[model samples]
Target: MRRVVIIGAGLTGLSAAYHLRQLRVEADVLERETRPGGACRTTSRNGFHFDLTGHLLHLARPESQKLLREIGIRNALRSHRRRAGIALAGCVTPYPIQINTYRLPREIRRDCLLGFIEAHLGKADSDTQPRNFLEWVLSRFGDGFARHFFIPYNRKLYCTDPAELTTEWVGRYVPRPDLADVVDGSLGLYRKRVGYNATFLYPREGGIQLLADAIAATFPPVRLSCAVRSLHLGAKEAVLESGEVVPWDALVMTAPLSHLAAMTADLPAAGRAAAARLRAVAVVNLNLGVRGPAPRREHWLYVPEERFPFYRVGIPSNHGAVAPPGCHTLSVEVSLPAGAATASGLRERCLEGLMELGLLRDAADVVTVDEVHLDPAYVIFDAARPEAVSTLRDAYRAAGVALAGRWAEWKYSTMEDALWDGATVARRLAG
Candidate 1:
């Protein structure tokens, strides 16, 4: 590639630029925002620090861990034992809910074990593949667990019918307990660790954005506040909002692939419509700086109750001493529907939730409530998502356009996945 242009200076875009420099390929990175880190951004409010959303570095992959060390934040990255839990039916149950059912109420525990036994006996097993996410959950966990956790939690997160979504993306991120694990859990004897993120990593200070900031510092200074307004793929050029025309040998776009069809003048009508149908959940992050001890010592909680407007809560203070002396912090994630209602009322909703959940003692203890909303936080996998994503990628690739990151790839992924995406694309483009 003679002249490579990377759009969006998020981790992926910055990673691409970093690797390109190693290959002696100088690249220009364009970011519309004033700062570099996209979704991995962190803000300091008073004495509390809050990320864009819940972001923890899982150094599960060797390559990902190596990248961290290379970025010089490895020492700063603190190892955290995952103490995540779920708030269901007014009870705090250990996560995976399968291995930890022993802590649940007797009747609920019985139902969960029996469901697992039935599913394990092959009576509930179906030879046909699961048609949707609900089916997959039911087949592996049965109705008891589904009704209590999976169904409600997913509904809150996706804001869509789980049955309408395909099971393609449910590739074992959630633990599927067998008979032994289920029996032990129900009998109050299970102690096995479950889930892929059993142990994770986070920065000791500066919140999660330290990783993003460290990575960004390695790349050449980015062209900030430069949004791509239009693209002429055939001519290998981009028109920025500032009326500056950027010419390139190859375009590496890290923005949402579906959202790009409108910008590129050469995309076909069918591709554009397919792109339009792609759906994702917008995330509203509410961070509270409190004047007392944290309600719990756990890193975070998966709140599945309907009354609670938030799906997940991250205790940033637990990760490190993010809050000032005599204060604690909590970060909450709330999903919004297609057309979001007015956000003016969301603060009260979140405050009420924290109090109801027994986290906040009184309204007087509240310090600061920082609200940050991220558009298209999660890629909603409907029947159309696969086709839409494929169509978008095929069209872009055919035009010699390179894509990078979770948004551009339109896949359910983690931070490591995003980094890998950028590195892979940069290598391919440079090759």
Candidate 2:
């Protein structure tokens, strides 16, 4: 294909451009925002940097880590052992909640451990698929673990019942402890961490956005603030909001599948229906730069209890000097319905939640707070999602469009996943 065009300047699009250029293939990137990074961008205010979300650089794949080093963040990245926790029973306990139940009350610990053991021994080698996320958890983790942490925490994160979600996206992101590991962890005797992100890397400075910045540097200026209004598959053209039509022989779309489907001119009816049925969770970040002790005591915490509106809260200062010395920056995520607007007290509610959790001794401890809205954050993997997304993907291939990135693929993915997706598509297209 000639005259290639990549849509969205997020890490995926940038990676595609970088790889294509290395292959001596010229490609242009278009972004709706003025900045390059999408959710990966960071904001600096009064010497404190607030990452837009809980953007941790967990290098699960060696190839992805090597690429980051090649992008010039090798020396700048600092590795930190994960010190995350879960809030339950009015106390903060070590993370991988199922395994770390020793801190719970006597009855709770017994129930969790017994249930886990029963599941471990009786978990048959059947081939029947779990109908939903709840069933998957119940079958694998049993009642105690499911009721206590898995269900509540996920419900808070997705803002929906777990039974509504499909089990397709769990892949390797969630930590699944074995019988030995679970027994040891629950007894406070587990020495080894058992999770996908037991340890992660972050830039020594500039928040998590540096990874996106470094990748963006290798590509030419992206057409920023230029939202695509329509795509003509027949003519191989993308129509911009400014009424400019750009022609291309091939296209890489990193925008949300719904947006792409809406913009495309002659997409099949099934594709349109699939896009319309897709579900996602909206998220808002109450980013606070405070004068109190940094939330550094623990890197991040998952709030499984329903008393708080936020599902997760992360302190960037815990990983590095993201804030001024002795000061801390908090990034809190509140999940909402997809496409729903107007969270009236989301910011205030988040601050109050921090106060209740004792993270903030009082409101006076706060210095500055900013609310950043990720309109469509986590794509919910409901049972209908896979089929819907498949219909869209099949249509996309027919229309000669390559999908890249988490949102484009409509899956819950990591930064490494995005980078690798771009590289894979670029390699195939280059040949």
Candidate 3:
């Protein structure tokens, strides 16, 4: 029998193990955390269940739905049309502000609409191939929309200048409405949902961890709280934090690519250099349990203004019964460069911003506060990412290491993509 070891035990790792079991193969899943879900884990405080962050499932593929049904979680998830918006200039407008400019201030609406018309009429002269994300936005949505929403919102979320990012990771995530749609939006006539997350599914009660836990139950028990200290690639062995070495013929890695690069012992100098070039941002997630009903009816809101410490805020209770009967939950997200020190008093700043926006009636309404810092929360898709990822992948592949999941591939992705990645890698290993 060929020995196989899967690391991370995230959704991707669990899926890989589950699929491997179906193929009559067995693999040991090692998880450094006490629980299975990586970023998908949820916590309960004062009867309020809070996820690490918002993790809604957008399942576009049939296989994903089939897997959920097979795992008995299909009935647990309920579908919902997204009630999301962008808050700016003291007014709240539906999300994809590109198509819902009608609710924005008159001046901003005029700028966005006129900019779209001008760009549409001059599409022939604009660059067909954009050099960066900034160029792409300008060419597609024009300067007005770029200046108002895309540029500022992305800047706050990615924690970098939009011009510094590449367009490689923008597929399906950003909606590019036609001229007619834009005009309709300017007139408040557009009602159709746009973007990949226009509609999604969430667990009715267990928070997002229910999906992870369900998949994990289909396979052998995962070794929890066992951290991987380093990898001896040539030796096909992984050294645990406790000094135990586990050997395997095939290794599936679903953790962050940066971690993989740091741990591998036999990586070449060029591989190390490539790893050094990879960049990502961290997220300081603040989950709050409020004493009353949710302040906003929308599931979440995007904050483009720089004055707000948080780029986004979510009312988790609006989507599920995660809070007590009379209580609600609030999630605030602040992004920083990976390994960057979180600014002092960030929590207080977030509360102030929320109250300023009227999302929070009073600071005294709070019950419990929990903060989770996730380093490498989002991969910065810069110009050098392609070459860097390719270099690291080639170096690791030579040693029989298979990478799976969003952090492993070092790209933007959803929970569904993670499941597919796991199954695909598992089948390859089984063969």
Write out the backbone clash pairs for model 2. Answer: none
Q: TM-score winner among the candidates? A: 3
Best by lDDT: 3
Ranking by TM-score: 3, 1, 2
Model with the higher TM-score, candidate 1 or 3: 3
For model 1, name the residue pairs that clash: none
Q: What would the TM-score be for candidate 1 when compared with the true structure?
A: 0.96
Per-residue lDDT of candidate 1, residues 1-431 (tens digit): 48889999888898899888878888999999988889988888897887778788765678887888888988988898788888776788878787887677788777877777777676544577778999888888888888878888999999988897788777748887678878877766777676778888887877877877787888678989899999987888899998889998888999987568778877877788888888888888888889988899888899977889899888878877689998998888899864476467877888899889988899889888888878778888899888888888888888778888888888788888778888888899889
Candidate 2, lDDT over the whole model:
0.85
Enumerate clash totals for all models, in the order shown.
Answer: 0, 0, 0
Higher-ranked by lDDT: 1 or 3: 3
lDDT of 3 by residue, 64-93 (tens): 889989999899999999999999899999
Model 1 spans with C-alpha error above 4 angstroms? 123-125
User: lDDT for model 3, on a 0 to 1 scale?
Assistant: 0.93
